[model samples]
Target: MENLDIAKFGGTSVGNFDAMTSSYKVVVGNKNSRIVVISACSGVTNLLVELASGKCSDSKINEIIEKLRDIHEQIIIHLENQHELRNYIEGHLKEIKEQTLLANKGTNDQLTDSIVSHGELMSSYLFVALFKHYGTDAQWFDVRSVMRTDSKFSCAKPICEEIKVLAHDKLLPLINDKTIIITQGFIGSNTLGETTTLGRGGSDYTAALLGEALGVATISIWTDVAGVFTTDPRVVKTAKPIPELTYIEAAEMANFGAKVLHPSTMIPAVRQEIPIFVGSSKEPEKGGTWVRPVTKSEPNFRALALRKNQTLIVLSSPVMVGATGFLANVFSVFAKYNHSIDLVSTSEISIAVTIDAGTTTSGKAEISENMLNELRQFCHVKVETGLPLIAIIGNRMSENSGVITKAFDAINKFSVRMICYGASRHNLCFLLKDGDTTEALNELHKQLLED
Candidate 1:
C-alpha cells in the first residue's frame, strides 16, 4: 500500500448523520484513502467525561447516558440498517452506564479508560454501517489490536516498535482498494489487553502514527476549520486561515494551543518526513494548509496561539542566582509529578514556570499541593492563577528585531507577567491575565498577521 493515505476526521467532521455521510464521500472520492481514523462524536466525549468523573449523582450519570444515547440515536436513525446498529449502540451505552456506576465505587484510571472509550467504539461501528450504506465496502477494525501502548490508563504512551509489528501482521493484509479499514483513534490496549487512551486530541496523533506505520504518502486531517489559522477565529473574527506552514511552524503552533492539531500529532509525521494536509471536511474543494519540511512562504510573523488557564509558579531561592543544578532540581520535581511545563522564565534568584491550571489533558490535576510542599523545602513558592500563555509562531523571530518590536508593541499595554523567547526562533510566548486574552489577541493579530 505504498500509495495509501490515512484520513483522520475530528469529532465535528463526523458528529452526525450528514457529517459522517460527507466524510465517507471524501474517503470514497479519494481512492488512496483506504484507512480512516475517527474521533468521538462532537459532544459525546464531553458527556462521557462527565460520566466517568464519578462525581455526579446517580441521576446525573443516568441523565448523561441518556444525552449520549440521544446524540448517537439521532445519527443512527438515518442509516438504512438503523435497527441493527441501534441495538448495537444501545448495548454499548448500557455497558457504559454500568461501568460508570462501578467506576464511582473508587478512583480507577483503568475503568475510566473503558467508560469513555465507548464514544469512539460506537461511533466507528456507526461509521462502518454508514459507509456500507453508501455503497462503499468498509470493515470496522479495533484499533487496540494494532495500536499497542503502555498501560498508562488515561494517557498511554505508544510502544512504537510493537505497534509497527502489530500493524503489519494485523492491518496490512486487510487494507486494499477493495475495502476501507475503519478504526477508532485515541483508544488503544496494553500487553494485558486493558483499554488505554492517549489523552485528549490523541486522534490526530493516531492518524500520524498509522500513516508512519503504513508509510503512507500523505496524512489528511479533516476538521471544522479549513486549516491552521493566524489565530482562533472565535477569539478574533479577522483570524484568517494560513495556507502553508513548515513543520517547525506547525509543531510550534500545535504545542502553543492552536487546537487545530494535537501537540504530539506532528512527531511521527516529522520523523518520517510525511506531508500532512489539514482541511475542512465540509468544504474539501476549497483547499487547506500543507505542512511540510519547507514551505514556499516563510514569514517572520505567521500566527498567534492563546493557551488559557495557565498557572504561573515562581520558585525563588537565592542559591539559584549562582547555582548550576537549581533549574534541574526544579524540573525534577515537575518530572516526579508527571506534569508538563509550557513556558518558563528565570531571573537573578528565581525561576517561574507556567503549567496548565486545573486538570491536565488526562482529566487529572495538573499539579498537586504535595508537589508544591516539596518545593517549599528549598525555596519560596509563589503561585499565581488566571494567567494565559500567548505564543507568536513564525520564522527567524530571534534574528529579526523589527518583528519582535512589532509583536510586543501590539500587546505592550497589557501587563505581561512572564516572557519566554530566544530559546525557539519559531515561537515567542508570554503570559497575560486571562481577562486580557481577547483584546491582546486582537491587538497582536491585527499588528503581526494582518498588517
Candidate 2:
C-alpha cells in the first residue's frame, strides 16, 4: 500500500472563500490519506501586524474585521450544508475578536505573534468546516500541541525530536481513522505554552516538518505560481520554469531569492530525503517543478535567482601587519548582531564582505550610512550600495568544467564587482550593479536554458 501524502497550501492559494473552495477540490481529487496545512488569508497577517503595533486606527481595525467576516461568511453561504458550518464560522470570528482585544494589552512582539496567528487559526477553522460540508471526513488539529519550540516569538526553532514523538502519539490516530486533518501552520507553542510564530511564509516549513515526522512519501506545496522559475517572471520577460532540481540547487535558489519556496522549508524534507513538488492551485495539470536528490541526467541549467539591495563593505587594516585574530574580532561584531554574510573576499590588507542592505521604501540601501559609521574603528571601510547578487545553481556544475568561466564571459560586459563560487561548486554567484541584474539573468537564461 502507498504511504499517505501531505499537501500544503500558501496564502494566495487560500486568500479568499473562492480560492479556498478551489484548493479543497484539488486536495479531494488527490484522494490520498493526507494532512493539509494552511497559511493565513492573504492580507490578514499585515493587518494584524498593523493593529498589534498600534499603527492601525480603530476604523482600520474594524474595517479589517468586517472584511475578514465577509470572507468567511461568503464561504459559509457557498457551502452545501450551510447551517452548522455557518454557525461554526460565526462563533470562531467572535472568539478571534475577543482574543484580539485581550492581546492588544501585551508587548508588541507578543501581540504580533498573537494577532498574526489568527490568520492561520481562522483559515484552518473554516477549512475544516468546508471539508465536512463537502462530505469529506475531516477534522481540525491545533499544531501547537504537536510542534514544540522555544519562546522565540517571531522565529521559533522547532524541537524536532519532541515534535516527532508528539505528532506520532497525537496525530497518527486521527490519520488512522481516515480523516483528512486540517491544521494551522506557521504557529506553534513553546515549552511555556505561549503562542509563537516561525517567521513569515513559514507555513511551508510546517508542512515539510510534519511530512518528515510522518515519513510521508511526498510533500506538495500548492501556490499561486506554476513552479520554481529560471528567474522571477515579473523581472525577466522570458523567464522559464525549472522542471526539476537537486536539494542543494533548490536551497541555493531559495536562499538567493526564489520566492516560491522558503530556504528553511527544505531542511526537514531534506533530512528525511522526501521529495517535494511545487504545483499551482489555479492549474494543477501543468505539472510543476519537482525537487529531490541529485539525478544522473546532466541538466544544462538548473535555475537563476537574484538578491538585490546588497551593500559591499570593504575593511582595510594597515594598523596590524598580518596580525592574527583581527579578522576574528571583526567577524564577532557581525555575529553579535546576528547579521548574515553573503559574499566575502579578503586580502592581506583588506577584507570585503557583502550583506543585505535593509532597503527603504524608495528601494535604496538604508544600511550604507549606518554601516559606514560602524566601520570607523577599522583603518578604512568603504560601503557601496545598489548592488545585486546573481546565483546560478546546479548539481552537475560540480563536475562540469568551464561553467563559471562561460558564465562570467557571457556577462563580462556588465559592471561586475565581485564573484564568489562555493567550495562545493554547486553554486556560482556574482555581484553586479542592480541595474544589470535583469539583463544578466536574461542573457544567462538564453545561453544556458533557452538556447
Best by lDDT: 1
Cα lDDT, all candidates: 0.87, 0.77
Measured with C-alpha atoms, the lDDT of residue 340 in candidate 2 is 64
Residue 134 alpha-carbon offset, candidate 2, angstroms: 1.4
Top-TM-score candidate index: 1
Off by more than 4 A, model 1: 357-364
- Model 1 TM-score (2 dp): 0.97
For all predicted structures, in order, the TM-scores are 0.97, 0.85
lDDT string, candidate 1, 1-451, tens digits: 6678999999998899999988988898898999999999998888888778778798898788888888899887778877788899889988998888886887477888888889999899989989888888899999999999997778889998989999999999998879999999989999999999988889999999988887889999999889888999998999998898899999998888888898888899998999999999989988899999998889998999888778889999988877798888889999998778877888999988888642333454446899999999999999888778899998998786688888889888998888899888889897886675888889889888885
Clashes of each: 0, 0
* Model 2 ranges with Cα > 4 A deviation: 80-107, 309-314, 355-387, 396-401, 434-437
Clashing pairs in 2: none
The 10 consecutive residues of candidate 1 with the worst lDDT sum are: 357-366
